[model samples]
Target: MAEENKSCAFRTSIGGQALIEGILMRGPEQQAIVVRDQEGNLVEKVEALKFIRDRYPILGVPLIRGTVNFLDSMVNGVKALMYSADFYPDEEAAQPSKFEQWLDRKLSSKKLEGAIVTLSVILGVGLSVLLFMVLPTFITGGLLHFFPGFPMWGRNLVEGVLKILIFLLYLIFCSKQKDIYRVFQYHGAEHKTIFCYEAGLPLTVENVRIQPRHHPRCGTSFLFVVIFVSILLSSVVFGIWPITNVWLRTAAHLLLLPLVVGITYEFNRWVGRHVQDNKLAKVLTAPGLWMQNFTTNEPDDGMIEVAIRSLELVLPSEKGKDEW
Candidate 1:
């Protein structure tokens, strides 16, 4: 834990996502994806990032930027994942369905990539809503019907607990998969490399290996924070309005999700900006840090190399430009 308190001169706004056999790092001005190809060579793709806020100033506002950035990250992440997967396709993987084949033939490569990314983002958001928002409300509402004596607060509590349990179970199941475990290992590598960079250490496998795999600014922590904020917000809303209809309650939760995400993102940013030894920040971030155990795994030296290369490619040209 003492090592966790190691300080550096600056905190960075750079963040990343784990891809199939690769790591995607996004700095303030650029993004890079580095994957280890089957031929045992590192492949890197780097591009300048154009922020939507540059053209649309309104989206740059604090709470509003959170939602915008979250969506942007999702789109970029899906694209990078697709790119990384292309390098190591499984020969035995299932063939595309007739409809998929038809779409592939009808759409050009660029169009197909855009269409796939759009659909992926929609499906991903829908599934999140179904599992975390709708399912919990449905389950808790069913319990309330069967047990009329169940109090309103109890219903909220049950729903919140159910949401968290479902998330944890999902993470556990994903972590157990052979392919996903490798991705989680890359996730750890991404974190460790970022930690090493933040600590003002040289980007080397040995240095990264000793750094903490769990980062306060991780997307995993952002997700856990979202769940927590949703739980609290839902409880307060249900308490005030006392809605009993399950579907209506689910709709309300869905409507509140954007706000929950915004608040959680801001909280994460605040925690990220604080020194690691700050007691209040540590207490606030503890739960998310604890949850990282399922989302990150120790990485091999090869994985660390990929992470290092990715980070190096995306580092801002000017020092302190990425300061939190």
Candidate 2:
């Protein structure tokens, strides 16, 4: 394979993401997108990513910086998708597929599409509030009604139990989708490529297939941290829920999201970097690793090839700056 023959030229740690009909790769210096067009030809685009850290040192601080990084990634990802969409000709665009037609009919306008996406995210948070906050509160409040004398911490205990149940069910349901399964296969491809590179193996499809699919720095792990952190943080802040209003409690949870994400980001980063030699790091990451069974599957060589090309386009030419 080309990756094996040109191993030394490739950046070792660059990673990739599977997109709707393409791949996105992020290297130290640049991010690249590659998509298969309607004509089944590969089209690629590359962009240099200059971080604010180069100019303002203070902006690079841990917690403060993650928020900006998350937001930037979201915006850039959308732009990359839009750019790739251009590869499909106007005639092809007019005869939209079921998903495209659905999106078109529902969104109607670009502004409407943006609004819908924002609303969808908000609705997701709203559902989380409904499950973790309102439903749990109701259940615990009912227990209080039954016992007529339960302590303050009892509410938090019940809420935690209910939240865990809700999270588990959500994952189970989402994992059942056919398209989601395909995406998960690509997810596995992403992890295996990173693993192959980290292990000093030549980054070929055959070599990558032998590498593990579970990645400590995965978004899956970040979510596990969010759930676990919510439990811990809520135990402190929402424990005495009998004394607080529901709206106030929900607001607190919403506000704490950035903190949770930032902390999880930092932890996952540490775990990914250290899991090679550290038993404790592996232990901490076990749940997320197990969860990958539902979120990742064996990808075919074609998918891996797309991923490899995506990674190649973004990799740094310079030494000592090859992280994905």
Candidate 3:
């Protein structure tokens, strides 16, 4: 009977990430990772989630929670990625260097993994900030130096354009990679399954395969919104206090990142809530959805099966409990 009801009504807070030959789904109470091994058998690992907010309530506050949750997502995502990668190791994974070997021997296995995952998250965040935030500011400021008469607004505009351009190019580059294409296909499957569930349809291969691959609440959308919000916020801040030096501008951009993320998170929540009924909300999410063109591809039946199973594991026992 539930399978027969296809009327779309609400969205769920549950979301997922496409991984190497796998999918990771996060729900209200837990997260699950399902991977298709070399033998074509499905294997899964599920963990009960413990929220940081549960330990520190203040971190759950709206604006503050965005940054907190982003970090939490990064950590979990990296851990899941590592786990999935372990199943499909490189053809030639180099031997650990002397220092790395020393650390491995010195630390417990769990501690070593924790250290590596923490380091990966840090490096990931660092690389993202440098490439997307700092690099744009550096280029804009460098160019503006040659034109002393360029207005602050002009400088901000250039930086914003550069940010968007770099973001687009990065996605395009990733999409072109042979390995990433499969991940993107799985990404599509994730979106499709979420859409099918939200529409009250049974999660079947036929149902999910026909669903749109792009989702407004996707991480790609949130990332784009982060850049968009930063552009708007930076324009205002840079207008107020013009910082011409590349290094100073880069520092200012870094400082504003948390605020940008917070605003984007709140905006995403609002958009996610209103997208079904509000015209403006739909418009707001269009670009991010469009960006999915590069980040998502049509998944095959097996990939859809992975998505469906991954979603099933994480779905709450109570209906409507996961409603956004």
Candidate 4:
């Protein structure tokens, strides 16, 4: 039954992330993030967004779409994260100043949120720069004293390996927390629920439980692909740099991230759509699925219910007329 359902594609094409204590669902037209608060009631926020492609058709093109989508997702993901964090009354969130609130009273909700969105994007970019640029450069620069005169390729290989290792180590560390584990379980639930829908099965807890949590198009899989793509792209770019300074090479890697992410996003899309029928897709994506074992645990029905409710809110009204 599961195998047969896998052949069908008409379901929902939306995707989401399990945030701090909530679920965020992103659809074609609008996105919603739903969180269960301390009062045990669901708090939901919906935002309507226009895709860059809709605004500028050229951005929807192959290579361009990947880059645009990556940035768009990052921006939206942060907003969803902020909304999800609001569920905890004790959570320390940045509140608008009195002056800003006064302005918000006069301005529209859209204007107020637009300011928040801009700030969030700035913070996200700053965080990425610190992690991917500064940290790697510092670590790799320190390594050079012990292994001097290595070729440029060798140094780049070290940096790439360290970056992947650091990323994995961070995941491992975070997965140890009890709250994070529960979030990971919900992450698993999200994947299984989507699988059930795509398989043309009723989106019930029982059916979703039987489906695998590892999805080909998952963020986990995408991250793994990005790491490898970074290694390849960074090596090619780094080859031009002299072997003298690790900081220079690391800086180059950071600068090339958009291209690397763009390529990986396109590759992931291709593999995800073809995985069910193509043997090679399965092979390439196997590591990602395996890695998901560390990231996703079996979720209970309550968690699945939360996922379902979150998904239902974001699905398009005309969803069933054609294949997703």
The window of 10 residues in a row where model 4 has the poorest summed lDDT is 85-94
Each model's lDDT comes to 0.89, 0.69, 0.90, 0.76
Residue-level lDDT for 41 in candidate 4? 75
Residue 280 lDDT in candidate 1: 96
Q: How big is the positional error of residue 231 in model 4, measured in Å on the Cα after superposition? A: 0.7
* Clash pairs detected, candidate 4: none
Q: What are the per-residue Cα lDDT tens digits for candidate 3 across 1-324?
A: 123223456889999999999999999988999999999999999999999898999999998999999999999999999899888988776666799889988999899989998999999999989888999988887787789999888888888999999999999999999989999999999999999899887899999888888888999999999999999998998889988888887888889999999999999999878887788998899899899999999999999999999999999989899999
Candidate 4 lDDT over residue span 1-324, tens digit each: 247545765545588888876788887777888777777677777877577788799988887788789778877887777677666645443676799779788979887777878788878767765665567767887877787776777777777787777778767877888878988988988888888878767878888888878777788888888888888877776676564565566567677877888899889878867777778988999888777877888888877877777777777767563233
Candidate 4 ranges beyond 4 A from true positions: 1-12, 44-47, 91-116, 240-243, 319-324
TM for candidate 3 is 0.96
RMSD of 2: 5.6
The residue pairs that clash in candidate 3, if any, are none
What TM-score fits each model? 0.96, 0.78, 0.96, 0.84
Better of 1 and 2 by lDDT: 1
Residue 138 in candidate 1 has what lDDT?
92
Model 3 spans > 4 angstroms off = 1-7, 94-97
Task: Write down the TM-score for model 4.
Answer: 0.84
